[model samples]
Target: MTSVTARTEREVTRGRTRRSLVRRETWISAVVLLLPAVVLLLLLRIIPTVTAMAEAVPLGGERSPWSNFAYIFSDPSFLNSVWVTLLFSVIVNPIQIALALALAVLLTKHIPAVGLWRTFILLPIAVPQAVSAIIWLVMLRPDGPLNGLASAIGLPTVPWLTEPGWALISIVIVCSWVGVGYWMTFLVTGIKEIPSSLYEASALDGANGWRQFWSITLPGLRRPLLFVLVADTVSNFLVFAPVRILTQGGPQGGTDLLMHNISERAYTLGDTQAASAATLVLVAIVIVVVTIQFRMLPGKED
Candidate 1:
């Protein structure tokens, strides 16, 4: 009986040892798998941000450690760029998300040739933004295809890229054209994941399309819509390609977004310090905006 008890104890010990070995191996494997991504994140994102902060610091002879910030804040062009970037964000983010949601809802129906239509919408995403801007540049010219079509339809040929108001609007249009489809793709996926029974049940209760959308679709799409909102906001704030290729900051400073202003400061004006400062400012603004979005959006915990 004592030998039997000892044998049982020995087997339990062996099992625990095996379990411990398996756990250790699992931990090591997880570390190995995660190392590459951690290294890349540190190298690509964290290091560059730290370098920008370092470069934004004042020189030895400066009045304060914030001289770069002071310099940019005092400049009217920089102030204008800040305002313009904010305005652009305000205009573009909502328009993109709204149109994206609209298209997502429309396309999720049992419409014929839905795949072909989706391809046409998402085609712009496959094209590079700079290339897309160039295409828009030609089309937006005074006597280009857009204007010719307007004339053929007996509408006035609007100065798309020339006037200040229209130049900013043109930037918004170009950005929306690229962004809406991309955002819609995510929304469509979220919509599809919603249980079909919920829609059917809602319909049986006499809910129409709009009512069903509000009760079923919108609630189901909360997470993806939040993601799209935050990402679209950040992308619009960083808009530079269209502004650069089409307007070059424009007839006035209408489309002079912060990124373009930072590039101009660093390269055109040879003020790397100011550009770095502006970059930090842009980062701070994005952080604040994203934080607000997180708080506002309902999450799983909510």
Candidate 2:
């Protein structure tokens, strides 16, 4: 009996040691897989951010960077970029979120040809952003197919990309076209994760479709909505490609986005310090905006 007890104890000890060895191996493999991504993020995001702040401070520079912020603020071109960026954000974020929500709801239904519809909606997202912008740029030109169709349909020819106001609006449209479908994917996933029982219970309570959406859908989607809002805002804030490729910030600087403004300051005019300062400012704006979004959204319990 004693020998049997000792044998049992030995088996238990061997099992625990084997399990510990396996767990250590798993953790080592995870770290090995993650090391490259961690290093890349540090190099690409963190290092650049810190370097930009440092460059903007002007510790050993000839001219005082004390005026760098003042320079960016006082400059008319920079101010216009700020205005353009804000306007774009205000218009595009809501449009994308609303359309994404609507599409997500529709896609969740048992409709005919639903798979095809989802595919078409998601086609834009599969295309690269720069490629999408170029495609839209071509479509919006005066001699483009869009105007041709407009003329053929007896509608008035619209200036999609030329005029100052229209150019900004065009940029918003282009960004929304690519962003809406991408955001819809998240909303749809969130909506589906909501248990079907909740909707059935609400239905049994005599709540209509609209009521269920308001009570069940909206409350359940709080987290995804917050994510989409903040992400869309950040993306639109950093909008550069449309302004660069299509309008070149033209029609009297109408589409001079903040990123373009920073690039011009740094590369075109050889003002790295000012550019760095503008970058820092842009980062600050993004941080504040995202923080506000988080605060405004309903918490998990709510």
Candidate topping TM-score: 1
C-alpha lDDT of candidate 2 relative to the true structure: 0.89
Q: What is the lDDT of residue 113 in candidate 2?
A: 93
Kindly list the per-residue Cα lDDT of model 2 for residues 1-302, writing each as its tens digit: 99999999999999999999999999999999999999999999999988998888877768775778888889999888888888878888889899999999999998999878888998898898889889998999999998999999999888988899999889988888888988999999999999999999989999999999899998888889888888888988988887888888988998898899899999999999899999988889899989888888876674
Model 1 lowest lDDT segment of ten: 56-65
Tell me the RMSD of model 1 versus the true structure. 2.7
Clashing pairs in 1: none
lDDT of each: 0.93, 0.89
| Cα lDDT over the full model 1 | 0.93
